[model samples]
Target chain A: MTPRLFQRTASAVLVVLITVSVLFPLAWMAIAGFKGRNEVLRSPFQFFPDMWRFDNYVDIARDPEFTRAMGVTFAGALIFTALSLVVNSLAAYAFARLEFRGKRFWWVYCVMPMFIPMMAILLTSFMVVTKLGMLNTMAVLIIPGVASGAQMFFIRQFYLGFPVAVEEAAMIDGASRWQIFLKLFLPQSAAPFVVMGIASYLAFWNAYVWPILTITDPNLTQIMQFLGTFRSARGNDWGMLMAGSTLASLPTILLLLVFQRFIVNGVRISGIK
Target chain B: MALTPTLAPGPQTADAGRSARGRRGRVKTPPHRRDNRTAYLMIAPMVILLGIFVMWPLVYSVYLSTYEINFYRGSTFVGLQFYRYVLESPDFWHSIVVGLYYSALTVPAMIIIALLLASFIKTLSRRAAAFMKTTVYLPTVVSTVVASVLFVLIYQDEGVANWLLSLISFGPVNWLNDPQLALPAIAVPGIWLGFGLTTLILLAALLDIPESYYEQAALDGAGFFARLWYVTLPLLKNVLLYLFVTGFTLAIQMIDLPLIMTNGGPSEATNTPNLYIFNTFRDVTPYATSYSLTASLLLFVVIGAISAVVFRLVRSDKAIDG
Candidate 1:
C-alpha cells in the first residue's frame, strides 16, 4: 500500500476503536436496563438480555419519590436557566455596551467568582443561605446559583463581538435605550442566550453536592442526589440501578441529539474565547 | 417645519431638546450619561446577587475558618487554631496528596489520548469526522452521577471490564474495592468523561493552524512525525497549556464520581480534597466546620497560585501569531 493509503486505513481503525470504547458503557447500561437481575449479574458479558423486562421502569414510575425527584430536577433546571439568562445577560449587556462609573471595578468583581473554586465557598455559602432562612427549600437550590460569573463572562464576550451600528440606528430612530436593547440587542443575542441557558440548565440538573447538603426532605431530592441514595438503598438491584441511570441520562442524551450543533458551538466558543 | 412642534414639542422645550440631541450626536455626554444610568439599572440584580452569594461568602469563609463552632452551643473565636490544626492533620495532607496524584494520573493521560484522537479525526473525511466527534462527545453531556453509576456496573468483579480482561487470560480483579487499584480505577471514568472535551478543544486549535506550515514542512521532505513535532505541536503550545491548567483545576475538584462509586472507601485511597471537605462538614464534629473551611481555603490558595503561574507561562510565549 502507498503511504497515504496506510495512513488512512490506520486512522479508520483508530476511529472505530474509539467509537466502540466511548459507546460501550452507555450502550451496555441502556441494554441492562431491560434485563432481569439474574440476567444482569449472571451474564455480565452478554450483549443481549435473555428476556426483556419493563419491571424496572414500571417500578421507577410507580415510586413517588423517584417521580418527585425528576420533577424537582426539571423545575430546578428551568428556573435556574431562566434566572441565569436574565441576570447574566443584563450584566453582560452593560459590560459590553454601556458606560458607567466603577464599571471596571464591577466587571472585575463579577468575574472574580470564576477564579475561586465553588468548593472553597460551599460551607460558608450554606451558612449564608441558612442565615437568610432559605435553607432546606427549593429556593436554596436556585437562588445562590442564579448568578454565574462564567456565564456572564461568555455572554459579555458574545456581546462585545456584536456591532454597535444597529443600536445606533435604533437610537437615531428615536428608540429609547431599553427599546433598542429589547428589540435589537436581545434579538441578535439568541444564540449566546441559548448557549448559556443550556449550560445553566445542565449545571442545575447535574448538581449533587449542593442539593444534597441543602435538601433534607426526601420529596425535594434532586435526581443526582436521589440516585446516590437510591443506589445505597437498593444496592443489590442492578436492574433498577441501570434503569435509574438510564432515566437520569435520557434528558441529556436527547438534548445532545437535538442540539448537537448548538452544544458543540457553545463549547468551542466558550473555550476558544 | 409644521411638524417641528409636534416632533420637538413647545418652543422652549424644542430648543432644549435640539441642544440635547446635538450633544448626543456629537459629544459623548448626553447619551453616555443616560446609558450610565441604564447600565447601573441593568447590572443591579447581578451586583446584589454576587454581593450576597459570592463576595460575602468569600469573606465569610475566611472568617469562619478562624472560629470553632458547635451546633449545640454558641461559637467562639479560635484565631489561627483551625488553620494550624488542619496543617498538622495527616488526613488533610493525605487528601491533598491524593488530589495531586489523581491530577497527575488523569490530566496527562487525557491530554495525550485526546490529542491523538483529535489529530486522527482531523485526517478523516468530513462525514467520518462528524460521526467520530458526536460519538466521542456524547459522554460529555452525561451527568457525573449517571456516568459513575454506569461505570460501577462495568467495573464490578464480574463486569465487562474483567470480562474483557479474561479474553486476554487475566484473572478477575476488583476495580473499586481494592485500595491500590481504586484511585486508578476511578480515573478511568474521569478520563472517559474528560477526553471528549479535551479532544474538541484540541481539534479546534488544530483547525486554527494554517495549512501553509504543513505544506512548507512537506516541501522540505519532513515525515509525518517530523511535521507533527516541528509544525503542529509548536503551534498548539498555548492550547496545550490551557488544557493542562483547566484539566488540573477540574481534576482536583473531583467529587461526584468517587463519592458515588467508591464513597472514598477502600481505606480512603480515593479521598480527594473536595470529598474530604464534604465529609468533614457532614460529620458535624466540634471543629468540623472550621476544619472544612480551612481545608477549602488552603485548596483555593494552592489552585490560585498554580493557575497564576500557568497563565503567566502560557501568556509570556506565543507560538502562533494571529
Candidate 2:
C-alpha cells in the first residue's frame, strides 16, 4: 500500500472514531428518553428500546417545576442578552471609535476581569448580593453578569474592523453621536450582536454555579439548577432525567443548527468562557 | 475670507481630508471634548456594574478574609491568621492536589487529542471535515448539568460502559461511586465537552499555515512525519501555549461535574479546591467563612502564577522568533 493511501485511511478512522465518541452519548440520551424505566436499567442493556415511550417527555411537559423553570430561565436569559449587548457594545464602541482621557487605563480595567479566576469572585459575589438583599432574585442572577470583559473585548474587535467611511458618512449627515451609534452602528453591527446575543443567552441558560449559590427559592430556580436538584430528588428515574435533559438541550441544539457559523465565529472571536 | 470649518478628525485618522470651514470650528468645543463626554457616558453602565460587583468584591473578600466575624458579637480582626489556617490545613492542601490532578488528566490530554484531531481533519475533504467538526463541537453547546446526568447514566453498572467492558470479559467497574476511580471518571466527560473547542481552534491555526511551506519541505526530501515535526509544531507554539494556560485554569475550577454527579463524593476524591472552598462556606461558621475566603484568594494566586509563567514563556518565544 502507498504511504499516502495509508495516511488517508488512518485519517478516516480517526474522524470516524471521534465522531462516534461524540455522537454516541447524545444518541443514547435521545434514545433512552424514549425507553421505559425497566428497559433503561435492565441487565445486558438492549441497544434499542423494546417499546418506545413518549410518556417521559409528555410527563415532563406537564410538570409545573419543569415548565416554570423553563419560563424563568428563558426570561432571565433574554434580559441578560439584551442588556449585555447594549452594555458591551456601548463600551466597545467608545473604545473602538471615540477618544477619551484615560482611554488605555479604562480599557485595561475592563479587560482585567477576564484574567481573574471566576471562582475567586464566586464567593464574594454571593456575599455582595446577600449583603444587598438581592439574593434569590433574578436581578442578582442577571445584573451582576451584564458587564462582561470578554464580550466587550470581542465586540470591540468587531467594531475596530468597521470602515471609517461609514462613520464619516453618518457624521456628515448631521447625526449626533448617539444617533450615529443607535441608528447607524447598531443596525450595521447586527452580526456581532446576534453572535454575542446567542452566546450570552446560551451561557445564561447553562449557568449552574451562580444560580446554585444565589437562589435557594425553588420558585426562582433556573432550568439548569432545577434540572440538577430534580435529578437528586427524582433519583432512579433515569427516563425522566433523560427526558428533562433533552428538553433542556433542545433550544441550544436548535440554535446551533440554525446559526452554526455565528456560534463558531463567536468562539473564534472570543477564545472560550 | 471664506471662513472654513476645520473638522477635527480623530487621532487614528489624522491624515484625513483636512479642508473644511474654519469659521464653524469657533462655535464648537474641541472634537475630543465631545468624544470624552460621550465615551464616559456610554461606558458608565459597564464601569459601574464591574466596579460594584467584580472589583469591589475582590477587595471586600480580602477584608473578609482577614477578620473573624460573629454577627451577634460584631466582627474581630485577626490579621493573617485565617490565611495561616488555610495554608496549614491538610484538607486544603489535598484539595489543591486534587485540582492539580484533574488538570493534569484533562489539559495535556485535551491538547494532544485536539492537535491530533485537527491534523487528521486537515487531511479530509472540506465537506467531511465540516461534518466532523460540527459533530464534535455539538457537545460543547450541551450544558455541564445535562452532560453530567448523561454520563451518570452511562457509567451505571448495567449501563453501556459496563456492557462494553463485558465484551472483553472484564467486570463492571464502580466509576463515580469509587473514590479511586471517581476523579478520572469525571475527567472523561470534561475532555469530551472541551476537546471540540480546542480542535476547532487548532484546526483554524492549522488551516492558516501556508501550503507552500509543506511543498518546500517535500522538495527537501521530507517525509510526512519529518515535515510535520520540522514545519508544523513550531508554527503552532503560540496557540498551544494559549490553550495550555486557559485550559489549565478552566480545569482547575472543575466544580459542575463534581457538584452534580459525585457531590465531591465517596471519599471526597473529586473535591477540587473551588468545590472544597464552596463546601467550607456552607459550613457557615466565622472561621469557615474566613478560611474559605482565604483559600479562594490562594486559589487566585495559583491561577495568577500559572498565567504569569505562560506570559513569560510567550515573551521569550517572541524574542526567539524575532
Candidate 3:
C-alpha cells in the first residue's frame, strides 16, 4: 500500500487508542460492579465476577432511598423535558411567524438566557425554589429548566427555514391565528420539536447540580447525585455503585436508541448555519 | 417628515403581504379570523411557558440579587450588596483567572485535534466512516459523573495510568492527587468526550469543499500544509470562529467535571466558578447557609458579560461572512 494508505491506517489506529481509552473505564466499572471486593482491588485481569452478584441488583432495588430517588429523577427529568418542548415550540412559532413589536429585541433576549451559566443563576434559583416552598418538589426540579435558550434558538432557526406558504394559505381561509398555528404550523414543525425533545430529555436526564441544589430530601434526590454519595473514600461497595450506575444510564441509552435519528439530527442542526 | 411615516409603516401591508409570502400558516378565506386564530394557536403554548418559567424566574432572580435573601429565615434590602460582595471576593477573582486559563488550554487543543481527525475521516471508506463516528461519539453519551468515577480509579495509586508510567521508567505522577496534574487530569475526559463531535462537524465542513480546490492547489505546487494553510484554513474560517466563540462560552460555564472528578480538590486548586456556586448552595450549613443570591448575581454578571462580548464579536464576523 502507498504512504497515503499507511497514514490513514495509522490515523485509524490512533482513533482506536482514543476509543479504547474512553471505553475502558466504563468496561472496568461495569465489570468491577459484579466482582467481589477482593477481586476488584487485587486483580486487574478479572474481567467478570467469580460468583455473579445478581443479588446486588436485588439489594439496590430493595433500598427505599434508592428507588425513591430514582423515581423522583425520572419524574422531574420527564416533566422538565415536556415543559421545555411546549415552551420551545410555542416561542419558536411566535419568533418565526409573529409580526409583534420588538420582535428582534425579544429574540435576542430569549437567546441570551441560553448563554448564562447555570452557576450564575444556580444560587438565585435555589433561593427562589425554597422561597416558594417548592423545595424538594419536582415543581422546583422541572420548572426553571423549561426556559431553554438553545431549544428556543434551535426551534426559531428551524421554523425560519420552513416554508411559510402553508401557514399563509391557511390564513387565506377563515381560520383564526390559533387555528392556523395548531393546524398548519405545528404539524409541519415536527422535525424540530422531535429534535428538541430528544436533546432536552437527555440534558435534563443527566443534569446533576440543579437537582442537588433544590433537593434536600433524600426521597427527592435525583438518581445521579444520589449515586454521588457512594463515592466515599473508605470501604463503600463498588458493586452497588456500579449496579446503580448501570441502572442510572439505561433510561438515557434507551431513549437515545428510540430517537437516534432525531437526537443525532438535533446535535447536527444545533447551530444557525 | 416623509421619513416618519415610512419608518412606521402600517400593519396592513404586513397582513396583505403575509398571504402572498409564505405557506406554513396560510389558511382559507375571510382573512381576519383565520389570521387571528393562526397567530394565537401557534403562539400560545410557547409564550405562556416562557413567561411563566423563564420570564418570571428571571425577574425574580434579579430581584433577589438586589436583596440579601437567604433560602429561608433571612432577608434584607441590600441594594446590590450581593453583587458588591461577589466582586470583592478573592475566590471570585481566582475562579475568573482559572476559568479563562482552562478554556484557553482546552478549546484550541480540541480544534486542532478535531481538524486532523476530520481530515482523516474524509479519506475513509463509507463503512469505516460510520464505525469511526460511532466510536468517537461514545464518550459524549456517557454521563460525566460516571466518567469521573472511572477516572478516579485510573488515577489511583494502584491504577493503570501510574502502572504504565512505571514500566516506561518514568516516575509516576499522582494525577488527581497532585494539585498541578489535577487541572489537566480533570480536563482530559472532557476533551476525550468532545473530540468526536468536533471531528464530525469539521468533517462536514471539510466535505463541503470541492475536490477541484485540492487539485488546483496541487497544480500550483503547494504542499499539503501549504494547501491546508492557504485554502482549507481560509474556507474553514467561519466554522472555526463559530467553534471558538461557542467553545469559549461553554468552557466558562463548565460545571460537571470539576464538581464530580476532583470536587475542586487539593486545597481548592481546581475549584471552578460553577463548583463554587454549588458549594455555596449546598455547603455544610451550621444553620442553613444563606442563599447564594450574591454569588449567583456576580456569576450572572460575569457570564453575561463574557457571552455578550463573544456574541458581539461573532455577530460582526457573521455580517462580514454574509
Worst 10 residues of 3 chain A by lDDT: A264-273
Higher-scoring candidate on DockQ, 1 or 2: 2
Q: How accurate is candidate 2 locally (lDDT)?
A: 0.81
Candidates' interface RMSDs, in order?
14.3, 11.5, 10.7
- In candidate 2, what are the lDDT values of residues A31-55, reduced to their tens digit? 8989897788779878788888899
- Local lDDT at B134 for model 2: 81
Ranking by DockQ: 2, 1, 3
TM-score for each candidate, following the candidate numbering: 0.92, 0.91, 0.83
Which runs of model 1 end up more than 4 angstroms from their true locations?
Answer: A1-11, A271-273, B1-34
Residue-level lDDT of model 3, residues B256-321, one tens digit each, is: 888877887777778877677667666655222334546665666776687677667655653222
Tens digits of per-residue lDDT for model 1 on A1-273?
999999888888888888887898898988888988777867448878888889988897778888889988898788888988899889988877776777769988887777778888888898899899997788898989888777887777677667778778887889987787788778888778776776777788888888888888887889988887776776778888888888888887787777777755765565462
Report lDDT (CA) for all predictions.
0.81, 0.81, 0.66
Scored against the native two-chain complex, candidate 1 gets a DockQ of 0.46
Q: Please name the candidate that would achieve the greatest TM-score relative to the true structure.
A: 1
